[model samples]
Structures are given as structure tokens and as C-alpha cells.
Target: MTSQKLSIINISYKNDESVRVLTAVLSKWFSNPKTLHFTSPNLKYPFNINHWISTFYNEDNIETYILKDENWIIGHISVKIDENKNLAHLFHLFIDNENRQKGYAKKLIRYVEKHIIAGKDNIKAINLNCVKKNIPAITLYQSIGFQILKEKKWLKMIKYIDKK
Candidate 1:
């Protein structure tokens, strides 16, 4: 994930009317009950959009990046870096179903590593919460150098950052 071909596209948060578009895209990604229900562990049912936005965007930790083709938003990835715990958590990572296997996730993650973590001076590790049911994500994370620091019914993954 750290080194991939997605560097060509810019990764950034959306604003203005883009938020509405991003929200629609998020709704679409969550349209599948199976995908949405099991994406995060310990999430209470009836996920609230206001709460989701508040948690990330209100405090400025949540980041939403669109993969655009000229002017259309093809996909997006959201991340939240918790300074309190020194954890850069991946909140939502999804590519448009039509745009999968193009290494979008890999590139976005690499962008996070370089600009988000490497740009900071005191980050300890990147941590994210994933449902135990998400084996595909678990496998991908493992392949991308993440290890299970702790595992309950869910997973808390951490990838330590170089401090020096």
C-alpha cells in the first residue's frame, strides 16, 4: 500500500457541493446491507450521517478524498487520525464498484502514509477498526504490512511509524 501507482491522482477532502456528492457516494457504498453492516465492528445499527460527519469533519480529523476522472467523482476514501492515541485510523475506504482492482486503495493508503503520517513528527502507528467478518480487508491489510496488535471479536491493527 505504501508504494503503488495511485500517485497520479490527487487525494483530498471534498467541499461545497462536493460534500453532497460525496455523501451520495457514501450512501451508495452503504447500500449493500452486508457490506455496511459488517464493515465496522461494535457500530450500533442505524448509523447516523450527522454523527459520522461530526466525528471526522467536525474536529477536522476525518478526511474524504475523491478519485476524479476529469470532473466526476469516481470513488473516495475517508481517514481519521487520532492524535490522542497517535493512531491514523482508516474510517472508510471504498472505490466505485466499477473502478475496483485499479489499486486505488493502495495508492490512497500510501498517500496517507507519506503525507499524513510522515508529514507529522510524533505519530506512533496507524490503527484502524475492522469487523472480524471482513476477511478481504484483513488480508489486504496484512499484505500491506499491518499486523494484529490485538484481536477480540474485532481487530485493532497497528503499523508502527519510524520515530527518528
Candidate 2:
């Protein structure tokens, strides 16, 4: 747990200013492929600001949460809900290095899980694809009862949500 206090708030797509702020923070945090990268298009930071802007403006299922510490923004989590599959997938989960090792990540996960449970009637799983190389993430997910069902070369590993 970190000494710094933080709060998570849901953001609407209409808020461009907040999105831009998040983009700036994420761009800095995800500047290296070693830390994070686009798994689909396979791109690295500085990720195209225009592309992110378009995503923020157009994606209907997208929901962003801002983690704020007093007046400063520390991190955010982006979730995309797939109603067809009844799944809420975590697309972007980034915490500023300085604010990490706190309970923020777990809190964010719990927040999103609650949102999923409340918003969708039959959501079965909350899925996320993490690089196999990210040991910390793997450990964290496992700690949260996420089991690795399948694995691809540094790519895909599916975890079925354990609805308890």
C-alpha cells in the first residue's frame, strides 16, 4: 500500500479536456514497449494523439476512470464493455510509477467489476490480455483469482471471471 491517497472517478466521452490530460499522462507512462503497447495495431508511444482523440470521441462502449491524488492526476483505467459476450474487458490499465504499489490497482479493479456487475445483466467475465513477460501483472491477476486458461506467444491469455 502507498502512502499517497487517491480517488477514482468515471469519465464521460464528452469530456475532451479530461481525455487529453489522460492521454498525456498515459503517453508518458507507456512511452516504452517494455511497459505497455497496443496489442492489436502493435504501436508504441508516443502513441498517435489523433488516434487516441478519435477513440475517446467515438467509442461508445469505452469508459475511462481517473485516479486523482488531491489536485494531481496519477492514473486511469480504460474499460470496454462487450455486451454481446457479456464481458467487460480492461483495455488500458496504467498507474503512474510513483503512485504504484499502493492499493489503487486493486481498487480500480474492484470499481470496474462492480460497474460491470451493475451495468450488465449477465456479464460472465472481465477479460484482459496481458503480455506474458509482465510478471507483476500476471501475479496480480492470479492473486485476484484470475486463472490463465490459454496462452499465446507474448500475446493472448484468457481468464474467465470467477463470479462469486
Candidate 3:
């Protein structure tokens, strides 16, 4: 099978429609209690756009990204950079259910690594957390050089990019 080309677009308030669609996609997937608990433990069921906006959009340092293949947005991720700590934290990474196992997640991750983590000289590492039961995500992160920080209910992983 041929690979699809993907682009990561930084989400903004102007892209209201895109965010709404993304929210819909998220709501659909998170309807499963297990999926919802894994991705967003604090979030309530039946994900709403208003709550999503209030949770993710209000922070200045956190930037949401949409992964698009051609004109279709098939994935989403959010990054929050801590300049003081020289760290970037990845949160709420999701690929549309219909589009999984297609390398979209890897492309999105590499985009973040190149443009966000490695692009900034001071950034020391990128960190993310996943449910321990989520083996696919753990495997993907490991393949991309992330190592488990410690064993816990939520597995924390880090990929260090700064050589200095």
C-alpha cells in the first residue's frame, strides 16, 4: 500500500469549524469508557466542545495541532512547552479510529520532534504519558526512542533530544 502525505497544522481560534469537527471525532472515540479513561481521566463522558475549549485552548503555552492528509484532518495532538524547565509535554494525542495503523501517528510525532523539540535548542526533552494497558502507543513511543521513565498506573515516557 502507498503511504499518505500528512501535514500538521497548529490549531487556532480562527479554525473553529476544524476544532468542532475534531471535538466530534474525539467524542465518538472517547465514548468507550476505557478509551476515555486512558486519554483523559479528568474529562467527563460525552465530550463537549465547550469543555474541550476551556480545557485545552485557554492556556497560552499549550498549542493544539491537527494532522491532515490532503484536506482531511485525521489526527490531533497538543503540546505544552515549559521554557523554565526546557521541556515539552505532549497530551491528548489521538488518531481517528478509521485511520489507525497508517503511520499518521508517527508522522505527527516526528513533526513535533523536528519542529518543536529539536527545533528549539534549549528544549531538553519531550514527555508523554499513556495508560499501561495501551500497548500500541507504548510500542510506537519506544520505536521513536522514548524510554519509560518509571512503572506506574500511568506510564510516563520521555524522549531526550538535546545532546548538550
Candidate 4:
């Protein structure tokens, strides 16, 4: 389950080719029960990819990233940055079934955190929320220096970063 060449590519709002590539990967991933259950349990299996893409475009502060292993898109994550709050919220983190438990999720999260810390001096913390029952996800977050800040239907977690 070890991957040597992993890439995290940001999906640009102005790039049609990137959108098409992501849509194609998501179209197949969205059909799998594992992906659907982990992503949007309330929504039906055949989720609306177009609607999802539209929302990604509608948000000015949100940046979507795709994880690729040797050209195959295996995971996705997004971050919503708030300058006023000085916080970057990470969400929509999903790794394909085949790529799970191989340390890719942590790598992606760390990459994004470093990217944000490097890109902005005002971003003081990174945040994310996960379902209460997702123990593996919670453990992964904890292992990566994220702390549980609050708990409810969705557990709120935060990791404060020091930019040097």
C-alpha cells in the first residue's frame, strides 16, 4: 500500500480541463458505496456532480484539491479560507477505497496545511468537522496534530499553525 509518487493538484475555477478530469474521477467514485457513505450519507448514491462542481465555483474562498497517484485521481480535499477569521477550514476529504490506510490522507492534509501556512501569514489555524461515528477519521486527525475543539453531531477539530 506504499505509494512513492503522489501529487496533490489544486482544481482551478477557470480550468475546464481540470474540472473535466475531476468530474470523470468523481463520477465513478460517487457510485461506490464506500465513497458515498463517507462523503454524503444523506444524499443518494448517484450524487449530482454538476451541482457539486457549481458549488465549488460559487465560493470565492474555497479551493478544491485532487490527490493523484501516478495519474489516477484517488482522493479529494477542499479548504475554505476566511481572512477575517484567520482560519482555513478543510473539508470534503475522501480517499478511494483502494488507497485507504496507506498514509495518503495524512500526507494530503499536511501538504495543504503547509501550503496554507506558506501562502498566508494571517491564517493561524486549520479546521475541519467530522461525523461522530467516524473513529478512523478522528484518530487520523488526532495523529496529525488536530485537536478536538467541540463535539456534537459533527466533531469540530482545529490545528493551530505557527508560520516561520
* Candidate RMSDs in order: 4.3, 2.9, 2.3, 2.2
For candidate 1, which ten residues in a row score worst on lDDT?
1-10
lDDT digits (tens) for residues 59-145 of candidate 1? 566666666655555556666777887777876766667766776667777777887678777678888777888887788888888
Quantify all predictions' global Cα lDDT against the true fold: 0.67, 0.69, 0.81, 0.81
> What's the TM for model 4?
0.86
TM for candidate 2 is 0.82
lDDT string, candidate 2, 1-164, tens digits: 34456678887656778667766776677677666553323454556656765654477888878788876777677788888988777766777787777767777887888765556767777777777777877777778867786677654444565555
Clashes of each: 0, 0, 0, 0
- Report lDDT (Cα) of residue 144, candidate 3: 92
Task: Write the residue-wise lDDT of candidate 3 on 1-164 in tens digits.
Answer: 13476678988644777666776667777878777777776678766667877876677888778887777778888888988999999988888788999887888888887787776788888999898889999999999999999887789899988565
Q: Over the full model, what C-alpha lDDT does candidate 2 score relative to the true structure? A: 0.69
For each candidate in turn, the TM-score is 0.78, 0.82, 0.87, 0.86
Error of 3 at 41 (Å): 2.2
Worst 10 residues of 4 by lDDT: 34-43
Q: State how far residue 43 of model 4 sits from its true place (Å).
A: 4.5
lDDT by residue (93-163, candidate 4, tens digit) is 98887888988789889888877655988999999888878899999999988999998767899999877
- Mark the regions of model 2 whose C-alpha exceeds 4 Å error after superposition: 1-4, 38-41, 53-57, 155-164
